[model samples]
Target chain A: RAHSNPFSDHQLEYPEKPADMDWSKLYPYYYDENTKEMTKKVTITDIGCGFGGLLIDLSPEFPNDLILGMEIRVQVTNYVEDRIIALRTNNVETKGYQNINVLRGNAMKFLPNFFEKGQLSKMFFCFPDPHFKQRKHKARIITNTLLSEYAYVLKEGGIIYTITDVEDLHIWMAKHLEEHPLFERLDETWESNDKCVQIMRHATEEGKKVERKKGDKFVACFKRLPTPEII
Target chain B: MSLIHPIQDIVSSEDGSLIFGIIKNEVVVFRVEEGKSQLVGKWVDELDRNEVIREKVEKEQARQIAENITKKRKTNDESAKTIESENKTAKIPTPGLGAPTVYSHLRNVTLSHGEKLLIICADSDKSVIIFDIDNDNKENVLQLKKRQPYPKRPNAIAISDDDKLIVIADKFGDVYTMSVDSDVKKIDGNVEPVLGHVSMLTSIVVVKDSENKKYIITADRDEHIKVTHYPQTYIVKHWLFGHNEFISSLSVPQWNKTNDLLLSAGGDRYLYLWNWGKNELLSKFNYEKLIDKYITDAHLASERFQNEENNLREYCVSKIVSLPSNRLVAFFVEATPLLIILKYSPEDNTLKLFQTMEFAFNIITMNVNNNQLLITLDNHESQNKDFIKILDFNENTDRFSTNESLSNNLDTTIASTLIEDKTSHIGSTGIYPLYTTINLKKHGESYS
Candidate 1:
């Protein structure tokens, strides 16, 4: 359950394009049947969201914005989905947990297929698969090429939040994001005051496990820079 | 049904007179003017013909062998490098163990804007070799201009409108742009990657918009068509995501004068049309029913790729060529003898099937030579002289038809033409596998 190969030929379902994606089923509270459109689109994403901890915590904070979690593991995604459903069911009168939902997907490969260009305001990488082996470094969630895609889906000034307990993977992720032309690493000051970063610090199940183990947590946040104009 | 010393791939001049054919590791030049097609001259891969290159290859191979850290492991083909970036440059053993007999088969060729230089990709070395096409000379026609090597072999290439920049998308998912006008003397080392996909880049096209703003549109094996701002490739404009399978071909029809409409097809059920600049899927034309019969056993994934449930019969749109005059585009699926032609309707922003032209033999490759469609057929079986046919547009019939008498003259000229057969080292199979686009599919490997 801890290991899911990103490159595996898993038959994950995805819409052909962002326009074709019907988010109403996932967040029925936001759907407007008359206009046949959702009142709000998913702006905050928790990629590789193992459980629903981050999604649940962020849902109350960004109530105006729709929050979605994408997990590759079938059992983990189902657990999160059921968790969200139970929360929404309990608070049926107020419809409290309707903003957060989890979908099973290989986010590394299908990010653009689900989100449009500059569609996301914030993307959370909450203790993603470190893929520690030197040879499997490319399989890491934050890579140069994959960062380009992340930059594509993220709006200008949008932040990418990455937290990992693995020292080597944290450096690897930070180095790739720093080296990329479209992303500029945020300082400690920016990380401290950012509400989403604070939520992610204590939110993910992995972060909680690391806390229980007394392991060091490394957090790196990068802001998407505006694409430079063609000369 | 493998090609045994045929014109593996080809390109022609703007005037349609000069033809540069890839015969194994050789580039053969033929002038088709008047009623006769005369073989001019040819340039073989220098590693075999020239002493200088052979020595260099030997030295390079020795250095690579010495640089190797681990004990030698056998490699099947070029995909080994793509699988892992580690230097897999094995030592050159005779046609024996640990040593690789260089094939250097010429492929993915195109001419300059003025049709002056023959730009081609060599499969063996992952190098882009340029040749000067001499219009005046009769004997020495294809003069080697430059041979620039890269970390990974280029899968697709595109030239800028002014023919100044050569954009190369290597199989490792990296795209790099090199100045074509500059001297390419520094052909040995790594060229900085400009932009890339996380997946294998299958095809690329450099097109200009209404305001003459250039964009590099690239298709990858992961069913993605990315349009990025040229030169400033850091600016990814948009991704046209429609196909569920590997997108192998991208075409901006010359007939689409507005230059916004894009034609894309690959390992999908339909050919996709996109108003790329606006990030809109204009329409998609279904080809599954049409190509159902042509999908043969060869289209099936090999035993390595087969799942326990079934052997997937997969095929990709290998090549797409748009006619210059009419809003007509012709494309052929991998290893299929049929060419499906379509007409793009600007009014509806949709593509309609116009014709499905079938041949006696499967098509090896195709190129649009100034409104004339030149197709190289897989005629290796009978050693048929009608290996290459130039189909011309018939205005009255509103279709492209092959002229028999003209083709006869070409067949006659081709029979007399000769290029040194350099494929003896490759053993029984004459050339490397002609169709590899199908292999791009990842059929769920058990890594656990």
Candidate 2:
């Protein structure tokens, strides 16, 4: 009964195992550290982790940390799985590190559900869609309302890293972060101290795409300030 | 040696000499010798330092003296009243043949028709004051105009080739285009008002196509690359969709006669080259990629990443300029200002990068003239004086390299020679120094 596939009983069922899915090959890093317990050093959620390029690159940097790549599409998730299997790395945690996993959900809505109050230590929005129109302001990933949610999910001293090639969006993100009382701007020195800015600029896949094209990339870092002690 | 201090302003003289405005209200002149810069003059005081201090002190002292005399005369007899009035009149400094001690706080400067230098100063109560530097008559040389009700403070101004029109775009999306031909200045025309973009309009370029059609290309905070045809029709032909951020700077490449190319630099860290005629995207280059390559080299790549990681850079390409041989150069502001040269291949319709200029400081603006790439470095970031450097691109190698054998470098020699040769041929008034820098430390506080 436990081994019985859940989808087999349904009329229109997904394949018993997704076609061509070699589970052993998909998660090589999982078994490599079988003796080691996953440490929750820093819980990071990468929104729109396209192809898991960032998640894969970051795994080695923070072996003890738990990292999650939130992606919308199944195809991309499978591709990321194949990439993780091909690498066969360890210490690098991923749910997909046991610590790191990919969730299939829309980031704009699912962020609150996955993250408890002050649950995330770091969040990265690398080159999020820039809805140019004023009417589409609500759709922007970094908005006043979204910042409040991000403020809620991010722990006191938690950081949000954003990078974009668009000058307008850079200003937009900077404005929102600067305006929000719960967050504070990080100076150049603070930005340099954090490895996330460095990684987002060069190591990330979006960063690579912009670099190949000789594009301008604007970066901003904000820290979620501790909410005033409830008097 | 290292740009002498941050350059405050750089002006080109009639004889092709380069004069820089420095921090202490001093002008430094550099004589172009061979290929390098020969320091002809350093700290040439534009304003009499001693006199400036003395006048300020004297004015305050005289006010005190006048008040004292007035009080004493009132207490004593009325005989000292005549002497008091005389003393008050005497304290006022008389205008003479000597240069004015007051330093000009140049807010904005532009080239006017008849090859005259027109400088607009912020000192005249934020009024649009124009100065004719070349004119001998001091009377009415500087005319103050009433400040227009602009949506946002203007960042810069651009004059048409004919100098018949002046356009100013504020930090907000409001753009005012006026015909300065009349004495009574009014907003005869303007670009269509755009909202939702609260950031300042960074740059404005007036492009005259091959067919003599005039188009105004403006970059705004909303990341909109808007093009409006002249004469109030305000028809936006097409919107450039590449940049995801605010457009910082825009330039219409004049390197080729046939191609109408628009180069744009955005906060997004990409340089975009768009063909205005066809409304087609030409090329895009990133700055971070260049920096990554420089950092993660053959020696460092292995040590930097335990597992062999890709040694590729992602860049925010800040500025772009088209060269004479159908080539374009881009400048990036990241760890340092990285310059990359790319050739536009007609056969493939692609831009292939060929060379790079590794230098310190963020490159704010760049222009190509007489086979020299003139760049303005962001001195404010480095807490140094601003500088305008003319770099010569090696045609053979497509790189910017100094010739070891020459005293000066190739760019200086070429620029000086070109100016000398062209001045004799055209008999035109000296080429107006093309670059200006604002002291952010000094003026930044006021703006904030």
For every candidate, give the share of true A-B contacts it also has: 0.43, 0.00
Calculate DockQ per candidate and list them.
Answer: 0.37, 0.01
Q: Encode model 1's per-residue lDDT on A29-127: one tens digit a residue.
A: 999989998999999999988888999998879889999999998898989999999999999998798999999888977788899889999999988
Number of the predicted model whose DockQ against the real structure is largest: 1
Q: How many Å off is the CA of B406 in candidate 1?
A: 4.1
lDDT of 2 by residue, A1-231 (tens): 101111111112111111222223222344346644322333788887777777877776777676877665556666776666555454334333444556554555335434546778899898877776654454567866357557767888999999999899999889978977778999999888777778888877778989999999999998888775321
Query: Which residues of candidate 1, in runs, are more than 4 Å off?
Result: A32-37, A82-96, A130-137, A165-172, A179-181, A209-215, A227-231, B1-4, B46-104, B136-138, B181-192, B288-316, B353-356, B395-398, B419-427, B441-448
Give per-residue CA lDDT, model 1, range B1-448, as digits (tens): 2223656788877667887778677777788878578888777665642343555577776665544422233534554444446555444434556664455678888998878778999876678888787878867777887888776779899988787779999876778888775675443332336787767789999988999888899998778899988766777888887788888788888877789888888878788888999988889998888988999887777877666866678787888888887789999988998998999887898889998889878888888877588888777665536668888888899888987776777766766555224341233645556786777775643432
TM-score of 2: 0.42
Give residue B440's error in model 2 in angstroms: 16
Candidate 2, position A34, lDDT: 60
